[model samples]
Target chain A: MRMNLKGQKKIINIETSQYPNWKICLINELKNLNSNNVEIDCNDIDLSCTDILELISIADQYNCKIISFCSRSIKTIVSSQSLGYKSQFIIKKPSDNTLKMNEKNITFSKSHFHQGTLRSGEYLDSPGDLLILGDVNPGAKVSAEGNIIIWGRLLGIAHAGSKGNSQARISALHLRPVQLRIAKKVARGPKEKPQLGIAEQARIDSDEIIISPLDAT
Target chain B: MATDTRVILICSGKGGVGKTTLTANLGISLARQGLSTAVLDADFGLRNLDLLLGLENRIVYTAQEVLEEECRLDQALVKHKKESNLSLLPAGNPRMLDWLKPDDMKRIVDMLKEQFDYVLIDCPAGVEDGFKNAMAASQEAIVVTNPEVSAVRDADRVIGLLNTNAIKPVQLVLNRVRPRMMANQEMLSIADVTDILALPLLGLVLEDEQVIVSTNRGEPLTLNSVNSPAAKCYLNIAKRLQGEDIPLINPAEESSGFGAKFRRLMQTKIF
Candidate 1:
């Protein structure tokens, strides 16, 4: 957690994923401040209306007035807004995943399989390799610590080797994704459309992410 | 007749994409087919389903009063002036937004399910509390979207939410389609939209001027203007909802049809 002090207003950005114990962590942080207006950045944490109310009551005990709320989660913003709090919804950049990877450990022993289309704003994350039987529509995302494979089209974002496995590859029947990521490298999707009926694969080649047709020889 | 009632939620994540219009027209069309239908306006905050159905001035009590035990359910339901089988139950006043919960929505829907064969809930825009409340009472959904990227994107998001909530058989309706623009490759084609959304095409509404006129006059086009292109589409949708086999209208053929070609030739001022 980072706290910035500026003229009776403190911006508390809870950057850690404390999961179930986030309230306790937030309360401990709030104890340090004395009668200051606070702005919270609840990045990617989904908070409900009752949870927001609990946050307000906790802040009341700390003499900290939460002036505004900002989150990358639509649910959090909606809940905070419903409680009559000034809230802002922050949109995450498409390829902004490097910072998030530092906290998660890579696991490549298991393979996860999903059977349906992943629509916009939906996310699928696997600890190991990820395989999907249906299309990944635009604005959807799938990430894995190992290889990623799609039996159908991949029109959205896919991140392979999310925890810095440089050898992990992403392959699909149609590889026209909005963005592709392999370990630490990120590349925009190919500008031109792929030839019909040809499956493609993307992987790191000479430190650059490159796309090549999956040769089924 | 089907024994179990069908509670369908008509929702579009974006505003002005014709959720209320579809609900009103579909209600009338179903009622015309001798089935009792009730349209629940879940968008009480910006209530306009009553206005579209031309029952705005006739609403005495709303679902809010029924839930509060201030009025009977039948008293709150306003029967259509022309369509005797069609009824509209306005949700509540704008101030009732704060206290309205998903349970209240379910209670109202449960009560309506007992009296009507079909209950169409006109959901509000945005995937917030209002949308959730409307969604809670629905078993199936019809996601309405325009032939635009933003509208399709929002519909895709809403579809994802519906799937997570276990709403089955979610269908798509591509609204406000201009055949000329679609045929000329100027707008997103039917294939392009269906490819992304990946839902069964329920029906397509051709862009028609009569829709605006009907809305202003508080009469759904399907109620009277059978010749209107959009009205035919709405009737087809209602029939399809009743499990009728109707082939979807082809926008390519519509744009290049003989009548359209003749109209184009006449507008050239060559005569």
Candidate 2:
């Protein structure tokens, strides 16, 4: 179908036939079709879960956008939403050929950000990487399943890679922590005062937790 | 201290920072100034406010009795032996520690506030259930800390909690300060403690051997001796708390060193 309203846009519409081996034919046809916008019409097709998932993967592989999935079947509607495309996969009215698309990016970050100081007996735990914008005072703790980055003084306990990721690191502008841990290894602060104006990082080195200047690399 | 009846929790983040001692002595000193004061032993299982006030034997009923309505609030109050205006609502039963809710403490404190001018709650050591239970009813806070890194660190933490709970401008009572150590720069001074904790100076008490001796005798030192350096410290603290213009007392070597020089050179308060 030609989107005549936009001179450069085109829509490749796929209508299923009442044949037992229609999916194979559909895949073969979609393999060679080169269009940015595609519509899958499931008006009378028996769309299964596996077929819907494979269609999505195939569309992504060919760099073809599934602009809309027109389906009157209950199974297709439920399975499309269950596959995490609730708003994208919807029935297209025959009377209206206009397609609604939300091209907003979906981003998932593995790190969490926190602001302000964590005082004594306070805690902040993150399931992934954690970034703290303030100091972690004595008796306070911060734990994460990944790396921990503190922009301020760290005078408390910090546990990185809590889920047993030894490669996780803990970096602080001031790394004078009461205790530092990466995975299973733990290291207490030295008896002497930590040197000021030097940023430090703590990580597991050969099954031991080591603290060194960040510039040490 | 603010004239209106206020429930103030005497707490420290770390243990053994003399929270109970301050509560006992301050309660006595406040009573001596003609303010009707009620000292609540909020340290549920390990109650010591009664023993410190020398009213342990005199306590006929505990907080549990008043909470459960088994006894009247007046029935649970153990009046101080000498101070007519002072009384203690003791932490009655250790077994009831699990059952004592924060609301129960509030109800009890509310009942006492109607009768007393100041309700001083002796909070537990850690910021746990007992501490929350006590602080739930407090309108103000008095953080007690010693002149050391660990105590000051914990007090800073407690001040943070008080701030989070909307208990503003907490008063600090610096306890067990060795003037000689502070003079030698070996210990934290009153300025150093207040700077770190970011609180107003309520008072600074010296590390007197008499404090330990009086605790053993089951007596509030401010009432028993009244002339010991610690006792005089509490009296002066009470005066300052009442909005009086009293200078900070130099409990250290007044006859000889820089403390004396500073006292003479600057008539201004040290705290």
The candidate that wins on TM-score is 1
| Candidate fnat values, all | 0.94, 0.62
Model 1 compared with the native: what TM-score? 0.75
Candidate 2 chain A, poorest ten consecutive residues by summed lDDT: A99-108
Give candidate 2 misplaced runs (Cα > 4 Å). Answer: A5-110, A161-169, A182-186, A201-217, B1-4, B13-15, B93-99, B148-169, B183-201, B216-219, B239-271
User: For residue B244, what is the lDDT in candidate 1?
Assistant: 100
Q: Write the per-residue lDDT of candidate 1 for residues A130-191, one digit (tens) a residue.
A: 99999999999999999999999999999999999999999999999999999999999999
The window of 10 residues in a row where model 2 chain B has the poorest summed lDDT is B262-271
* lDDT tens per residue, model 1, B1-271: 4469999999989999999999999999999999999999999999999999999899999999999999999999999999999999989897767778999999999999889999999999999999999999999999999999999999999999999999989999999999999988899999999999989999999887778888999999989954677899999999999999999999888788798677546534432
lDDT for each residue of candidate 2 in B84-196, tens digit (9 for 90 to 100): 89999976587666878888888888788789998999999887888888888888898999988889888878877887888755898888877767878888777767655
lDDT values, one for every candidate: 0.91, 0.79
Model 2 steric clash total: 0
